[model samples]
Structures are given as structure tokens and as C-alpha cells.
Target: MAASLLYPFVLLAGALQALGNSMNAQLRVALTNPWLAALVSFLLIVFVFVAMAAVRPQPFPEKASVAAMPWWAPLGGIAGAVAVFMGLLFVDEIGAGPFNGLLITANLLASLAIDHFGWLGMKPKRLGPMRAGGAALMVAGIVLIARS
Candidate 1:
């Protein structure tokens, strides 16, 4: 039961990561001003929420449910908005393909470190030589791509 429950969460995480990268690329191409991009992104998010509410209205959750969220919870969306704008601005300097490859590689390394260290309440996993080799290869590939 637990394994089955976890599968969807894993898939969801992967989908979110891919979507974020693609959206970053699109945002870079679409918006000249970072502030405007952020505003537009937020407006779109608001529109989605409003549309959903209109389609299937639901009562607000209890105060405790809302209050239980950490301060960083809200900051995550804001930070992602800023990151997309910044990535768009800088992507030309580093070719988009190479930059995205490097970004994915970096995200993998960071996630591995977080998982291995048991950061953020996650269970620790052993970091083996295979993982290290994979990371090295990813970096080398990024370098080659950027150089070309």
C-alpha cells in the first residue's frame, strides 16, 4: 500500500521538475522584463485558482490546516517565479541546451546530497560510487555541450 502511494508522488515530482524546466525556457522567450514576467506568472496562477474555484467551489480549510504550513511554503512559488525570469535572462549567455543540461545535473546532485544527508526530514541513503560517476559524467557532458 505504501509503495503504491509513493509511486504517484514520485511521478508527480518528476513531472513537476520537467514542467518547471520547460516553463523556464518558454518564459525566457516570452518576457523581456523579469518583474513583468513574475507578475504575469502570478496572474496566471491566480486565474487558474479562480477558475477552479468557480468550476468546483469548496469551503476553505480550517485555520489550523493553513497555519500548519511553514513560512517557506509561500516563498517557494515566489522564488520559482524569480528563478524562471533569471534563468531566461542568463540562458543566452550559456546556450539554452547546455544551461538546461547543467541545471538538471545540478538539481540531481543537490537532490542526492539532500537525500543522502537526510536533510528536511528525509531518510538518509548511501551515496555510492556509481552515483558519483554518473554525476561526473553529467558535468563532463555539460562542459562539452557548452564548449560547442
Candidate 2:
């Protein structure tokens, strides 16, 4: 029952992502600049976060709390920027299905490696036959989607 209820939210997330991608892709096409499109996308995120912070008024993290985090934690923005840039650059030309498929493939492989090796302080999850099979199936599905 819980899984079924949660599934719609997952679907909704994908739907929302698709809409965002399409909007950004159009913006990039109009601007003729992926970098500008990405900038606008990120600026919107900043706006929303700023509004959210105002509405909720959460306390700022203490100096010690920031100091305790790994140095690499601060570099996550680069990854987010790359995602926005790539989506702006390619989503319209390549289409969402193939882009998502390739993204998912890369994400799954990276996640599996991260989990298996406990990289960046994640809990270690040893890979097994089922995990291997699932990853393989995902790759196969992506291949089929790309071929289509």
C-alpha cells in the first residue's frame, strides 16, 4: 500500500522534471547560449531557495558545523551546474527519453560503485547477483530506449 502511494510521487517528480527540461531547452534554443540558459535556471533556483528561507526562517549553520563537513561537499554545485548545462545543451536536440536514459545509466553505475565502495562517507552496500542483474536490466532498457 505504501509503495503504491509513493509511486505516484515518483511519477510526478519525473513529470515535473520533464516540464523543467523542456522549458530550459526552449530557453536555451531562444538564447542560443547554453551557459546563459543554465545561468537563468540556477538563478531561478536561487530565487526559490531565498523565498523558502524567508518563509521558513531556518537558522544558519554554525561555523563548526560547516567546518565538520568534508571539503568535497562544497563542490556539489559544480555537478548541479553541469546537469543544468547539459540539459540546456542537449535535451531539445536529443529528446528527453534518451537523455534521461543515458543520465540514468550513468547515475546507476556511479551509485552502485559509490555504494559498493562506500565512497564519500556513504554506507557500504556490497554488490551481489541481484544487484548486478538489476543494473544490467536498466542498461538494457536504456539501450532499447535509445534505439527507439
Candidate 3:
């Protein structure tokens, strides 16, 4: 499947992410601590997901399944905390548009590496010419957004 075909959904997700980041930033400001905001977010996430699981009646994940993962598998949650905290820190400095552009650009480059290397059990993908060009174009767009 072509990435372009999935771009719309990804774009929508980006918009939602922007909203979440802004909301979380405000929470950080109100609480006067990024960690508190992250804690609140985690609490809310646990509540919602737990409710969802109950509604759907899915079986709980086995301990063995979780134990099968590498020790660093839990770092993804830590990464989310870092991302949200940085968003809180930089959004006020750079404005939402520029911050989002830079953040998304960084994520794009990191994602390219992750995909190409098949990190964390993901299927390996070649860094083809077209994909590289697309990433370059995204970087150009990010620069333009930041400059504006």
C-alpha cells in the first residue's frame, strides 16, 4: 500500500495530536509541573482504557506476553512523557505552528529510521529514493513553517 493513501488518516491523527498537546500544555501550565500533567494524563488514560476494556470484555493480556518484550519496551511510555513535556516547554517559546512543525519533522525523521531498521519488531523497509525525497520535502515544509 502506498503511504500517500494513508496520509489522510495520518493527517487527521496529527490534528488530534495537536489538540491533545495543546490541552496537555495548558494542563502543565495550570498545574505548574509537567510531571503532574503527565500523571493526570496517565490517570485519565487508565480510567478510559479500563472502561473500554470492560465494555468490550476482552481478555486481559497474559503476564507471559508482557514479559516476552525486551526490558526497554516500557521506554515508549517514557518517550511519551518526554514528548509531552517538551511540547509544554517549547510551544510557549516557538508558538504552536512552529513547534508542531518541528516536532512532526523530528518524528518523521525518527520514524524513517525506525522503519528502515525495523526497530522494535517492526518489519524492515528500505529507505528508497522516493521516501527520502518525501522526507526532504517534509523538512523543507517544516523550515518554511518555522520561518513563517
Best by TM-score: 2
Where's the lowest-lDDT run of ten residues in candidate 1? 17-26
Residues 35-86, candidate 1: write the lDDT tens digits.
6766677688799999999999999889997998666667766766655665
Cα lDDT of model 2 by residue, 81-129, tens digit: 7766787888878889998778778889899999999998999999989
lDDT of each: 0.74, 0.86, 0.86
**Residue pairs clashing, model 1:** none
Which stretches in model 2 have alpha-carbon errors above 4 Å?
1-11
Candidate 1 wrong stretches, greater than 4 Å = 1-31, 53-71
lDDT of 3 by residue, 60-143 (tens): 689999889788988998897777778866677788888888888898899999999999888999899999999999999988
Quality of model 1 by C-alpha lDDT: 0.74
RMSD of each: 4.0, 2.3, 2.5
Residue pairs with clashing backbones, model 2: none
